[model samples]
Target: MAALGWMVLALVFLDEVLAAVAAGVWGSHAGGWPLAVLAPVVVVAVWWAFASPRARWGGPVVRRVVKVLVFGLASVGLWVAGHHGWALALLVFSVVVNGLAQLPSIRGLVAEQERPPAS
Candidate 1:
């Protein structure tokens, strides 16, 4: 069970990286080059500022909200970029994986390894 939980936890990071990729894809389609480069930078910045586990701000609740917002935006970006199937898949997978990661057994495993960031 813990192994499965850890895998799901790892998937969360992969999903986050894919979010940045989706943003880049959308930006590439929206503009020639600048946006393609800029979009993922913005996404990374937002994630680092609010969602990253070591971020200086935000408690657990805020962290969850930021994750949802980031994932939601990524899904929308994928859909707007004409990758509807990928968009839906990302959204569903993110939601399910994230929910699984929140289970007490899994959450405890993670919390034990790292102290929570500031609120």
Candidate 2:
């Protein structure tokens, strides 16, 4: 279970990176060079500000919503960018993994791993 928890944690980070890629691709399709360059930057900035683990802004609910939006938009972005299969995979994987991560047991395991060892 602990190992599974850790894997889930890793997946969460991977999901974030993929979401940025999706956003970048979408931007390139939505607009040309400038937006292509700016889209990922904006996504990263917003994640850092409100969705990242280290984020200082927003309450838990707000953070969760922001996270969902990021992932949700990523799914949409991939679809709009014409990567239909990828879009569906990301959508299902993100939803399932994220939902599973919220389970108390998994959260506890993740938290335990994050805790500093006894001095």
Candidate 3:
């Protein structure tokens, strides 16, 4: 489960890096430098907010809620900003893939808490 979480996180980070590069190149050419910077900033901020140690025990509820909220906001932002079509597609894909990837760990954690200890 820990490995899965780390893998998902690594993929998410890679996605962010790719998106940032795409935004920086395309956005700058399109006269949207703010987006080029904002893309990476938002990625870093989301990682810090939800993945930080303070949030370690926040549990599945918090994790899922944060994931949905952040992804939804990011999707909407992409749609509104009207960047590359591929960027929007990639964002949506990452959201769904990451969400699915984390579900097993979240369910396992929940079940572990619910189970009674053996005598």
TM-score of 1: 0.90
Candidate 1, 1-119: lDDT as tens digits: 87887888899889889989988988998895899999999989988988888877867888888899989988998899899999999999899888888789988878878976779
Q: Give me the displacement of residue 53 in model 3, in angstroms.
A: 7.6
Give residue 104's lDDT in candidate 3 (0 to 100).
68
Task: Using TM-score, rank the candidates from best to worst.
Answer: 1, 2, 3
Writing each residue's lDDT as its tens digit, candidate 3 over 1-116 gives 66666666567666555544554554445457786677657655665667433464446577567655655555555555565586577677777676665586754654665689
Q: Which segments of candidate 3 are over 4 A away from where they belong?
A: 1-9, 16-39, 52-58, 103-119
lDDT by residue (1-113, candidate 2, tens digit) is 77788788888888888888888899999997788889999999999999876688967887899999999998998899899999999999899888888889888986776
Q: Which candidate is the best by TM-score?
A: 1
| Candidates' C-alpha lDDT | 0.88, 0.88, 0.60
Range of the 10 consecutive residues with the lowest summed lDDT in candidate 1: 109-118
**Whole-structure CA lDDT of model 1:** 0.88
Clash number for each model: 0, 0, 0
Q: At residue 29, what lDDT does model 3 achieve?
A: 51
Model 1, residue 84: distance off in Å is 0.9
Better of 1 and 3 by lDDT: 1
